[model samples]
Target: MKSIDGISFKSLSSDLPAGLVVFLVALPLCLGISLASGAPLVAGVIAGIVGGIVVSLLSGSSLSVSGPAAGLTVIVLNGITKLGSFEAFQLAVVIAGLLQLTLGFLKAGIIGHYFPSSVIKGMLAAIGLTLILKQIPHFLGVDKDFFGEMEFLQFDGRNTFTEMTYAMQHVEKGALIVGIISLLIIILWDNPKLKKYAFFKFVPSALIAVLVALGLNYFFRISTPVLTIGTEHLVQLPAMDSWEKMVNQLSQPDWSAFKNVDVYILALTIAIIASLETLLSVEAVDRMDPLKRVTPTNRELKAQGIGNFISGLLGGLPMTAVIVRSSANINSGAKTKLSAFTHGILLTISVLFLSPFLNLIPLSALAAVLLVVGYKLTKPALYVNQFKLGWEQFIPFIVTIVAILFTDLLIGISIGLAVGVFFILKANYKTPYFFHKEQHHEGEVIRLQLSENVSFLNKASILLTLHHLPDNSEIIVDGSKSTFIDYDVLDAIQNFKINAHERNIRLHLKNIPEVISTNAH
Candidate 1:
């Protein structure tokens, strides 16, 4: 096969194996996200295909993978419930896509850059913890609810810890055995010696774990009826014959719902949350890239917009740049965006020809793979590294983890952001300006340097300094360091200049722009 774009055939070789791994990872996640969001199972699969093929084709990112995000699950579920139907929710997805497209054109993607590194790290850890907590039930065959609900309070009224308690009481022996074996296989496959072997290099640990789990389950079915896995403990894709039947399964949007005010509000909410999640995931993926290639954030937004648009048109859930799938792609040794495209192709092929085989794979195996993913995200080293950065960073990081674990993604992020802002404001309040005094032949010489960004919060301090300036002193007000000076501060400085002349204080201004006097006089 020829290379895509400028990527080499050698790269495609690596991408092919990585694509298989990602396809394996994306399958269960797509279904689970759809289940949690109250959308049709087919909707999530369509989104995975669109995100991989369409978004990967349009995206400037080489490694980031786009698909249904767990972060949007709550919003989607609530939207569907409020809109009264899946069709109406699909309409909202379309509107959200259009809104994201507008945001891309407006260059709103830069907003991602403003998020503190601590907060981003916290978000990553929070997702990791959420994954571990949510998957525990599935790992034990406690299929009471969907597999990918990240919220602490589930739709079924069971909290995260409570669900674990329930799962403990009703654990399936067969599923637990499969899950433990799969997790052990995954861990063993990560051995350095195994990685060095040519045969093992071509095989992804997750793929091996899944195959072994499937084999073990089958063996149990034939040999020990009592130990056989139940249907609910395994995947359950809808059986279909012919391409026509697959297409017939697709649901259409309710165009009449466009005029509803609540629909528009839901659309806006999805647009903002999806875009934010996409941007954050893009940032995180870029950091994880081995080559450290930077993704064009605005381009990513545009690509996600188109992906969501196409997915919504085909009765699919909303799409975003999902970190989980992207991380799997990167860790599996993917080389180019072609890996994502290949995964999309594989997803379609599996649905058409391999559904029965896929259905045979136990959910516990997938849960084991995700557990590994979660551990990687929340490794002890990361926590220790954050702690070493001092309390300024550590406080927000810990708070984000706690908040997300107790609440939802958006609320947790909002809390972390508020805390980060408090730190910034505190620092700003203390060091709004630099003042240095020197004794000279002509009385005291004072040099005042304004901070880079001086807002109204710094106005009082600046005013106080000006008021206390000794008479018959030479003072220099330097704005050279400042990029922005709030009008309130500038007005105060101007008033001081007038008073300085009358008080025999010589005041000099540097790099400070003249503003029109706002005084009525």
Candidate 2:
């Protein structure tokens, strides 16, 4: 048996370098996701820490990093409003975490297995596209809103297109100049000539670009021409007068909310959504793994559950196995869960030690990094490859992209799934069904022979055949001609047997037990 279920730390040193890389990438995302979610900035950091330390210890993934997910921003934002208080919402997060823990115990991770491959591909591509599109405004020094808002038009009445235009019109010369320079440095760092340079080879391109940009800002002392990330977008820590004060920042859920039916519904919603995102990410990360590491989904759920519970206790946002952070980890050459743990530790240390220094990091520089990240995701090759797979795949894939851009992530995916299911049914309907008439009586016996594979989509056609069969007719189902019969179809056939027996008709099934007698009539 192939074992795909254990973690080993044979090369802990390698993980540290990768972990530092992931930590740098995660810091901005943690803060930005928190801002997008309308939660306290520290909340995002807390979730990142919990995801890193707790989830990493428990999760099945070797390279995947969990944290406050951009996908859950809308849910958190709306949840706070609906729940009447942030503390109240924290309670919901706790419940949701426990629910996920229960789901893990139930081995419900199988749900991830059933998602159609095409849909998963479509989703990943769409996410990549969205990430690229959303990051462009930031790269150009347009800071009207935080990252990953679903609305093409933002709360400030500026659409993505408008933001680009606005940035061009009121271009901060300093910011634009620095951003363009940073972009050039990043591009150069990846160049064949510069890649071999000993100093540049191991150093991250983003870190170099950021350092150069920051140096320019300091040298010129230029306050104008560049849009700096203001206090509004920066991570904020709770006023820690003492240890007790810091703990006071954490909130306990009101047990009273449990009495309300909506609370349970919310809990289920979080569990389902969080589980889906985590499982999908696991699949994606596995596909990206150079070593072909397969993560256990049930263990992943438990990891995420623990992360979320700790997040809730500390007044942090809910956690999920986010693709963005996970991808960053993979691309950065992370080898083990140690990378995740270290990233969390970095998040903790930064807030505690180097927060003031972090404040110096230009939003435009971060934007430049994300812009590259986004481009990698939504590259032109993805579209071309998806299209080559044929219209059935292409249509849903394109629809998913459009729906995500126009509506939101969840809605767009639902729309894509519906269309995909329709196509499956249509294809099933076209499958030939053979009918054979009896040799003796007039329209008394008929035999139905199915194709190689019978799916649930064929249920309606089979049901219709059974419904309209003549009152005294005999029916025989032949699976010898079919390689595989769906469980639903088998159940339908068994149910028909009872009906046929009651009506004095014969129901015969071939290639199945006890369906026929050895003696001829």
The best candidate in terms of lDDT = 1
Cα error, candidate 2, residue 65 (Å): 1.8
lDDT of each: 0.87, 0.73
**Candidate 1 ranges beyond 4 A from true positions:** 1-8, 430-433, 451-474, 480-484, 496-507, 517-521
Residue range 1-521, candidate 2, lDDT tens digits: 22223444654545665677677667777776777777877788788888988898899888888988876777888887787777777878888899888889988888777655566676777777676676666566556686545456576788766777776776555566667888788778868787667566667777788788778666556554234444433333434445465566556767777676666676677778988889988887787788998888888888788778778878888989887777767765567777788888887777666767777766666666666666666678888998898888888778777776766666777887787777777767656367778676555678888878888888878877877787776788887878777777777777677667666677788884343322213
Worst 10 residues of 2 by lDDT: 512-521
Count of residue pairs whose backbone atoms collide, per candidate: 0, 2
lDDT of predicted model 2? 0.73
Q: Write the per-residue lDDT of candidate 1 for residues 103-135, one digit (tens) a residue.
A: 999999999988888888898898889888888
> By TM-score, how accurate is candidate 2?
0.82
* Candidate 1 pairs with clashing backbones: none
Angstrom error of the Cα, residue 343, model 2: value is 1.0
Clashes of 1: 0
Runs in model 2 deviating more than 4 A are 1-14, 148-153, 192-199, 222-248, 255-261, 427-453, 460-477, 481-521
